[model samples]
Target: MSCRIRIRLTSSVVICLALIYIVLFNGLALYSLTKSTYTPASVPVNRGRLYFAYLGFNTWKCKIPHFAKQPLPLTALASFPGSGNTWVRHILQQATGINTGSVYKDYILKVVGFPGEGVDNSSVLVIKTHDWGINERKRYQRAILILRNPKEALLAEFNRKNGGHIGHAKTEHFKQSWKPYVNESARQWFEMAEDWLNFTGDLHILIYERLKADPVNEIKSLLNFLQIRISQKELMCVLENMKGRFKRPSKNLTNYDPYSHEMRSTLLQYEQQINRTIDKRYRYTTRSHT
Candidate 1:
C-alpha cells in the first residue's frame, strides 16, 4: 500500500475505535446512574437469603415475591415545622436510594421546588411541606405525616428562631422572646396536625419520638407503606447512615427555661386537644415486619 493511503487508513481505524469507546463508556455510565437512583421493583431474593444465612446459620429463608409496577404518585412528607420531617427524608433517601423532591423554593435549602403550573411528570415527586388545610391534601396521592410532642416541638422552634443554626441574627423575629413564639408555634402545630388528621387519603402518621426510639422498625414500616422493597443489606446501610451521619444535636429548651408558665399552659392545652382528636383516627403501630 502507498504510505499516504496507509496513514489515512490507520487514522480512520483509530477514529472508529475512539467513537466506539465513547459510546460504550457513556452507555454503561447512564445505566449505572439510573440503577443507583432508584431501587428496582425486584432484586435477587437468594442474595438476601444468603446474606442472612451467612450471618447466622438460621434455617429461615427469605421468600421471593414479585411486585407489579405501578405509576408512582406525588408523595408528600408533610409535617408541622420542627417535627423531624428532614430526618425522615434522610432515612428514606438512604433506604430507597431515591431522590426526594421538596416543594419549597429556598435556594439555601437545596430543594427541588414545586413543579410549574400544570406540569406533571412521570416520576415520583416527594415534597416536604408545612402547609395546613385539607384543600392541599387533594394534590398528593400519599402523605407521611410526622408528628412531635407539641411542647418539645414548640420549644425546638423557639430555640431555632432564637439562636439555633436556622436563626437570622438580625431579624426581629429572631430577637423576640420565646414565650410568644412558642405560643404561636403551638397554635400552628395543632392546626397543621388537625388538617392532616382530617385528610381522607392514603396517609401514614409517624411519631417523632417513636422514630427516635425504634428507627429500624419504624423505617421498615415506612418502607412497606410506600411499597418500596429493600434488601437487608440496604436496611443495614440505612441504619448505619442514621447512626453515623444523620444524627442532629438535641435542642432541649427546658434546660434553658425557654418557656414560662403561661406558655407551658398554652402548649399543654393544645397538646391535649390534638391528642384527643387524632387518637381516635390513627393509632401508633409498632409492627416490626411487613
Candidate 2:
C-alpha cells in the first residue's frame, strides 16, 4: 500500500478512537450528575402495602375490564400537591417495574422545570400529582389518587419546598399570596377528603399514613376499592418486595433544591404548626383500617 494511503488510514483510526472516548467520557459524567441529583425528598405514608397495589395496577393491562399489551394513555396515578406525591409515584414506578417517560412526564410531573427525563417509556403511566378536585384528571380518562395526612402532608411540603422546617420558597411572597389561600386551602383539603371519601367517582383514594402502618391490608382495601382483585400469591410477592417512603425516617431528607435536617428544634415548630392547622377529616383512618 502507498505510504500516503497508510497515513490516511491511521488518521481515520485515530479520529474514530477520539470520538469514541469523548462519547464514553460524556456518558459517564452525565450518569454521575443524574445519580447525584436524583436524591429523593421522601413521600408521605399511606395505608396498605403500596407494592401490592402498584403491581396490581401494572397488572391492570391484563385485567378483566382492561386488556392491552400496552398501558392506556388515559390511565394515571396522581396525588394532591404539597404532599410527597413525587416519592409515592417513584416507589410505585419502582415496584411495578414501569419504564418511566413519554406522555406522563410532560403533563403529570412538571415540578422542577428541569428536563423531566424519564428512564423508560414502556412502563405504566403512574402520574405523580397533588392537585385534587372533581375534575383534576378530566383531561385524562382514568386515574388513581394517593391521599396523605394533611398535617404530615404539610410536614413533607415544609421540608421539600426549602429543605427547612418551613420552606420560604418565596416565604414572604408565599405568606402574602398564601394568606387568602390559607383558609381556602384548609377548606379545600377538608372538602376534597370528605367529598372523595364518599366519592362514587371513577377514582380510587389511597390514604397515606394508613398505608404506612398496615400496607398489606390497606393495599387489599385499595384493590377492592378499585374493584381490582388479585391472587394471594401475587399479593404476597408484592408486599414482600415493597418499601414506601414513610417506611424510612424522613427526619434526614434531601427534600428540596438543597437537602435539610428535620432533626432541628426550630424546624420542629413549623411541623407542629402544620399539624395543628390541617383539617381533622384526614386525621382519622376509615372504619375498616382501625
Candidate 3:
C-alpha cells in the first residue's frame, strides 16, 4: 500500500509541474501581445513574428511585406503637418506589409517601427512630405494627399513642434506662438490642398475625417489607388490591429482657447475654400475619368 501511494504521489507531482509549465508558457505568449503588431519595415526582427491565438481556431504569424527588388514609381504621401500622416502610414504598413518612406528622418519614428524613414525610392511604398513647394511636388509620379481640419491639424502640429508626438503643447504657447502659427499654417493648409489637387500625376485625396469614420473602406479605396493587392486575411489583421503607437490622445491639453476671433475667421475662410476646391476638383476628375 505504501508503494502504491508513492506511485500516485509521483504521478500527481508530474501533473502539477506540467500544469505550472503550461501556465508560464501561456503567460509569456500573451505578454508578447504588447509589442508592435507587425514587424519593423527595414530590418528582419525575431520579435516581429506575432502569433494571434485569439484571431481564430488557427494561429498564424504576421509577416512584413518585402520591398520591391526592382525600382517602382516614386509615390508621395503629401500632407500638412499633424494630418494623421504617421498614423495613416502605420495603417498602410500594417495592411500592405510594406514600409512607407518619409522625406524627414525622425529617429523616434524609425525606432518605433518606421524603418523606412528618410528612404525615398521605389523600395519604399511611398514617401511622406508636408512640403508643397514646386520642387517637392514635381518629383513624385503619384500622390496621396491627406487633408485634415485646419483647427485640429494646426493645433496638432503646434503640439508636435513644441512638445512631442502624443505630447501636448504648453498653455503658454497659446499666448506666444498660437496667433502667428495659425495664420501661417492655415494659409499653408489651403495652398497645399490646391497645389496637390492640381498635381500633374495620378492624385488621390484622402480626407482624415472619413478615414477615422470608416477605416476599412477608406483603406480599401486607398489600396485600390496604389494598385496594391491585399488579401482578406491581411486586411482583417490591419483592422484588428488598428490604433498603432503614433495616434495622439483625444483630450485637449490646456483649458485656454487658442483660437482668437480673427484667427478663427481666417481659418474658417481657408477651410471653406479648400473644401470647395476639393469638391470642384473631384467633380472634374470624375467627369474626365468617365
Best by TM-score: 3
User: Candidate 2's error at 290, in angstroms?
Assistant: 11
Best by lDDT: 3
List the candidate 1 regions with Cα displacement exceeding 4 Å.
Answer: 1-71, 111-122, 162-175, 243-248, 251-255, 284-290
lDDT score of model 1? 0.58
* All candidates: TM-score: 0.64, 0.46, 0.75
lDDT, residue 122, candidate 3: 89
Which of the two candidates, 2 or 3, achieves a greater TM-score against the reference?
A: 3
**Model 1 TM-score relative to the real fold:** 0.64
Where is model 2 poorest over a 10-residue stretch in terms of lDDT?
44-53
Which sequence of candidate numbers ranks them by TM-score, best first?
3, 1, 2
Instruction: Give residue 208's lDDT in candidate 2 (0 to 100).
Output: 72
Candidate 1 lowest-lDDT run of ten? 51-60
**Where is the poorest 10-residue window by lDDT in model 3?**
52-61
Candidates' lDDT values, in order? 0.58, 0.44, 0.74
Per-residue lDDT for 264-290 in model 1, tens only?
Answer: 777777777777776666656332111
Clashes of each: 0, 20, 1
TM-score of 2: 0.46
lDDT of 3 by residue, 188-236 (tens): 8888878888898999888888788888888999999999878899888
